[model samples]
Target: MLQYLNPSSAYEALLEFLAAGGNVLVVIMFVAFFMWALIIERIIFWTTAKDGVIKRAKRAWAARTDHKSWYAHAIRDRLISEAKQETERFNGIIRALVAVTPLLGLLGTVTGMVEVFDIMAVTGSSNARLMAGGISKATIPTMAGLVVSLSGLIFINAFERFAKKAEHEVSDELLIE
Candidate 1:
């Protein structure tokens, strides 16, 4: 029996655990952190994108780019046909990113479960201590994934709704008949 009675000198415990296949937990945490970072970056991007769209809408409504002038230019430039496609493309990116996050979380959960089963099958030891380590890591990453995904999802949906409402109000109020 080995006991680390000295809590101050616990470096050996870390070394021992890592030696006992605990490196998997570190990998799981890394994945979670990476996904969290991506989630934050996407959130920032969505905010910036919303701001840009709102500014454009406000400018259009304020007659900075008068519809008559733009319409005339579009007719001259033959870009009127492409305007619908451009709008669709922009909306698609917003919807796709908002919808894809939960899928990412599901992917993480499945990957983690695969790792857990792999670890279990190799050891063939129902040793609670050893098995629990992998299971815990598997679950921790999942928790992180779900938190990030849900936050981003809610923010995205709210932003979309607000943007749509704002766009409609500005367009309806300021369009020069």
Candidate 2:
């Protein structure tokens, strides 16, 4: 508990961990940071913008006088399309980011393995201390990438589901005729 309260200790630990992970870890960190930022933004939009958008679409839909005409049907479709676009905004990018994280980790793994093989070729024997750097580099980024991806996955799924449900709600509000 006391250790947790020490900010400097935590900061130092984080720096040390990053240093051990090498440059790939830094890339993963940036990717995770932006991915998380987008996720938070989507969550905020769902909480704040969802209803406003739905209300606006509903209002536009209610104002229509000829619900049965072909033109009116087109307008209704347009409103639904707009609502879906709004709800699904940024989701594709979020998924792409999430997918990229693990691949980055895999890249880190490959680089680390190369380092290990180089050391082996030079030393002509396996040396634990000499090899530890490569091992850590290989494993850390993979762990970091997977952790980042999984964390993002939860939010992405939630956002997708929320958008789907919101779309349905908005469609219901529109009341097709």
Candidate 3:
């Protein structure tokens, strides 16, 4: 019986998983890591930085005495636009990273299939056990990529909603005449 708590065994299992996943899994891992990092940063900003932004915008608006003029309205709009842009920063990049993950996984699948084909061509045998490793390689990265993308998707939507709500709240605070 193998002990799951053993560090050596755990390391060996990780190596096997990576070997079964091929080179593309490495790319998927990198993308997934950065994507999650960005997601966590965004969530932190929402928790901490968001209120500071709103407060600053409110303060700026509160300082303005000139109201009920076209120029003043334009200034208010600009403030709102700036705040919205700040809230939206890095979002497109996050979405792009999420989009790229699955493509990398697909690439892994293609490479793994090619390896399996190469093996069959060399040995001239359709052996199930031999082919199973290649199949695992092809599927593992796809699963990893999909899992990463799906997890990121939730945070992406939440970030957008948070930004939109912040914009609305700031706009209300600005109180256009």
Candidate 4:
């Protein structure tokens, strides 16, 4: 529908959704933002900086006249290590953030349930209308967390595969001849 496509309507819907999800959604928002930022940084590094690093290592290996010596092998290992470290930067933090999002969502669920219980205690009756807010708060965040985690996992796995492949390629290029 055109209404769904309208940016202002979408914005309003997002705001309303966040409001219903309560305060924990805010934390999830920040975590997702940070995780995506790191993901983007790594993607940029791969696209722009990764080739330069590979070229430098290959050049260093090529400049060596002695490729069969023990020292040459050591130098090759060091180059590969450097390339691995550069490619893997920020990956640990990104993974940790991905792991934490679901936990944050669990926290939101607990807080929301607590809210529901509190309303029940105050009202002394099972009021579906009043409890609806708490139920939404509990469920929305879990869904959001899961969504974020799944998306992040996909990217993290892709980047990791790329890093491993790059490492192997670099090692192959720096062959001991």
Candidate 1: Cα lDDT at 145: 47
Top candidate (TM-score): 2
Query: How good is model 2 by TM-score?
Result: 0.94
lDDT of 4 by residue, 1-177 (tens): 679689999999889989999999989999999999999999999889999989999999999999999999999999999999999999999899889999999998998999999999999998999999999999999999999998899989988998998899899999988
Give one digit per residue, the lDDT tens place, for model 2 in 16-65.
88888878999999999899889989989987889999998999989888
- Ordering by lDDT: 4, 2, 3, 1
- Cα lDDT for residue 36, model 1? 49
- As a whole number from 0 to 100, the lDDT of residue 117 in candidate 1 is 79
lDDT of each: 0.50, 0.91, 0.87, 0.93
Better of 3 and 4 by TM-score: 4
Can you give the lDDT of residue 97 in candidate 3? 88
Q: How much lDDT does candidate 1 score?
A: 0.50
Residue lDDT tens for model 1, 39-94: 55555645565445545544544554444676644442333223223223334444
What is the TM-score of each predicted model, taking all chains together?
A: 0.49, 0.94, 0.92, 0.93
lDDT of 1 at 13: 71
Per-residue lDDT of model 3, residues 56-124, tens digit only: 888888888986789889888888998999898889989998888888889888988988897899889
- Using lDDT, give the best candidate's number: 4
Write the number of the candidate with greater lDDT, choosing between 1 and 4. 4
Instruction: Tell how far residue 73 is off in model 4, in angstroms.
Output: 1.7
RMSD, model 2, all Cα superposed?
1.3
